[model samples]
Target: MGASRLLVSGIACLIDFDDAALSGPPASAVPTVRSGVDLLIEDGRIVEVGAGLPAGTAEVIDASDRVVLPGFVDTHRHLWLTALRALTTETDLGGYLESVAGRLGPRFTPDDLRASAYFGALECLDAGVTTVQDYAHAMRSPDHADAAVSALEASGIRAVFGYGFPVFSTARDLVDIRRVRERYFPADDGSLLTMALSPMGPSYSPIESVREDWKLARELALPIAVHVGAGPVAQRPIATLEREGLLTAGTVYVHANSLPDEELRLIASSGGSVAIAPAVEAQMGHGAPMIGRLRAAGIGYGLGVDVVTATAGDMFTLMRAALVTGYLGAGSRPSPADVLRAATLGGAEVLGLAGRIGSLRAGKRADLVLLRADAPNLLPLHHDPVGTVVSSAHPGNVDTVIVDGRVVKRDGALVAGSLPAAREALLAAAHRIAG
Candidate 1:
């Protein structure tokens, strides 16, 4: 769908906010839905959004019974682990580490990695998630890393390919990151596909090892993502990291459910972001969800579909889990609009992409999703549209998916690739790797 001009006409509800609200000026009022609006997309960007927009010489999409929203952003995911889906459903955090990491990780070949990455990315896009942060921790070799990156590039999804270094890895294994950076992402200037470093955090490795990885990330000037606060050590590791002055704004701490408020404040002041995986954390016995503490500390937090092994990968499930767990923890319900923000703009801020793809502003790349409002589950929408989306809508209701103004899914089906072929590839890879 390159070089196509598409006009989405008569949109029932256009949900977005002003880009100026992101500049940290005096906050404007919350964004509201504009009914009966039309959006004109040309050259892979939204050119106009208002009433009476002409659709001259442009392909038109009928959105009279759909709610158009900026595509959901997933801050953290292990896209290479799609072949292991549902195998770890009954396993908790410890079992996962021992089984998935220790046993299965060492067996994956480069071909397996590529197929899994492709299938995982397609699943995410089908669920209306346009952007993702793929924490690929199974990079067993330089070839494996290259294969994973190539698969993501081929999937046509916007992603941050996090080059993973496990605690058991040697320094020589990580030497290829520089080459990978230079080969794939030579231009460090705001490309849609960027590079990140997934270092083994202090919780899983020694302080010296953590220092080594963090130093490499700083030298490359790339973002760092690490797992923290899932075990019983509490905030001791974070306190030590703070004392050593290793924390920076590029750090993205995951699973901070057990952390105290003081540490959350420290992360915010240090300009770091947090990724809370409610479903995985709850299923795996990580402490109570920290939505209340995170909000009180004023930290920029976003939801993540941590692992497909334990939970669903769709943002709808993530949004619903965040809403329910957050309500239970805070003792006060969060608005549906607020939940949607966490899924979209909040995730963008975590990935440092607030100026680009979070909302449906005029100049932003047209990454959007159209949900069928006439579905039985979404019928009888009398009150808040956002509320119905958060509490009721599922992935099956996704009728159209657009990323960078290209139609990826039309009429509720993917525009490219056969689902059966993708599924067969995943199963074959899993059998070969897990055998």
Candidate 2:
């Protein structure tokens, strides 16, 4: 463990509120934003937050001219596809499937997977995203899974490695999933890494296959993440899952864009959550993002960068997309505070890690981001700090990022891991695979 650190003189958004806060009318919730606040962190957890705390042998980080908040949580991401960025920007879902899944996926080696995962994780950290649920769907072999997990461990970012079923395979077995669990994540030890099962849901798989996949997830006692309402399928996914007795809690439904209100209600009643990738959904023709519907259904939802291959992998872009799409598509205009909560605490709830890493409470893990409030684009530091973050902030405004009591990006540059080496390796792999 390192020395204790104190963050002083910053505007802080605690996001510490009950579920009823979101269910009630807008701005009806208790105020969580504060000014001239300080946070004390030690042993990888927040120790306290108040007006003025004594700095007892701690390193004092001046947070003046900054807006400090809980670091962003990305609920869904295909991190292994980072090297293939912009390859499918002009394509729809089918074209993405053809180019990424059919063409480039098969060409990846374990080294390539490691390079992509490490670089992708670092990119998220640089953008002040402290946590991510990496949907590792490109796992062609057990070696591939191991490579991705090791890269995440080395990157120092909090992550849930969603061990995915092998894509484009007829067998679609869970043999390697069990192996990975026993090897990398034997228990819920307090490490930054955890495991989840990413299986093709009822929409993309046969009932038998879905049954087997769900069985394996239960056997491992892991949470599930699956794609729903992503493309044309034979059956209504949520209804079919309910009918089959497989709609379980702690499951995150990704991209429920085309699902009806009743289906979203099913998710909420069943204690499930949704992960919306607004940028990818709008660009790839999945459907209008289901932000308004999700809010009306009272379902907890989080934003995601589904694939860097199609959109910018930053929460700033994602938040703005969610806001504009919420207005244009469903006539539900979410305030900047609402979107910020979704990006942070709401995302933590979706991943079932709320108790551990969501807010800036005294007991939670110390995952924090400090944005430059004095930046030219964010000047004036208006009365609504969260509004500035949601509307004007970008990755370039990320002045510092700390995850689990470790400073990863400080002074607007990444300080953890070997970024230069990771970049070279990723470029080399991209050349070999995409060429």
Candidate 3:
């Protein structure tokens, strides 16, 4: 499908956003859920959303029994780890570091990075995640980093390619941001593909190296994402960052399981965001999940499928896990709307792209997911749309997916060709790396 005029008609439910909704927190405006509406798009942007819109020459998509929503934005994911699926199932984070990152990561070639990134991104798109932050941390060389970027571009998923620098790398391993940015992300305005600097966090890197990396990212005006609150050594990371004047709204702290209350408050005050990968955090023993604490602090947070090696890399699993954990910890159930928002709009805000692709609003990019509400597991419609989405719908219920006004998945199948071949290539890469 071309990026021309398109109309999605007869949507059973539409989770649309208004200016007021984006003006405050996720729950502030209470997302406007409308029934039986049509959305019009042109040039890869939503132009009109309401009832009774004319469908002229535009390609018409029938969504009578489907739910239309902003495509999910996954705030954090190590895409290059998909080849090592379930490799860390029984291991803790420390074990993972020793076994995977220490042993196998350095052995990977540029071809391996390319294969894993391409496969990981397609998995997300097929599962209804249209945008993701590919935290490509295995950049053994500049060629390896370029391979990761090339794979993401080929996959057609909207992404922020996070260039993860290796710890204690020589000066030759450092990224030439100006040169690479010009080659891949030249516009410097807003494009589907953006860039971020993912550095070794304060807990791992020497403070001097951390300062240098932070300064480089800030000078480039790019967002920074780092792992935080994994254990005692990382307690109150925001304070250290604040002392160095490195904390800002562009920073996205991942995991952040059990920081001090004052530190959590400091993050919110400093306009920083958090990305919680609840399933992986709970399974990998990264303290308790921080969804409740983040909410209590009024800090913006979004869901992340941290690693495919340990968890199901999909939004449904992430959302359900977050809700269950939040309830178990806080002794109160979080609103379904809030959870959905975390997976979609909240994730966008954390990535600093909320104004562009978070919700079904006019002038926003046409990244959307259509789920079959009439599917067997999702049958017996409920009164609440958000509740239905959170509790009942699974990735299998995804009927169609659109990114940038292009119909990438139609009738539950990917429009892109040769996915089986890609899977075979991934299997080969995984086998070689494992050996």
Candidate 1, residues 265-381, lDDT tens digits: the string is 778788888888888888887878766667666677778898898999999998888888877775345567767887887788888887778898887888899999889998776
Per-residue lDDT of 200-296 in model 3, one digit per residue for the tens?
7776666687788888877777789988763344556788888888888768888877677788888889888899898888888887768677777
Q: Identify the superior model by TM-score, candidate 1 or candidate 2.
A: 2
Name the TM-score of candidate 1: 0.94
**Lowest lDDT 10-residue stretch of candidate 2:** 22-31
Top candidate by lDDT: 2
Off by over 4 Å in 2: 1-31
Better of 1 and 2 by lDDT: 2
Q: After the best TM-score superposition of candidate 2, give how far the Cα of residue 139 lies from its true spot, in angstroms.
A: 1.2
Worst 10 residues of 1 by lDDT: 21-30
Q: TM-score of predicted model 2?
A: 0.95
Worst 10 residues of 3 by lDDT: 166-175
The lDDT per prediction is 0.82, 0.84, 0.83
Provide the clashing-pair count of each candidate structure: 0, 0, 0
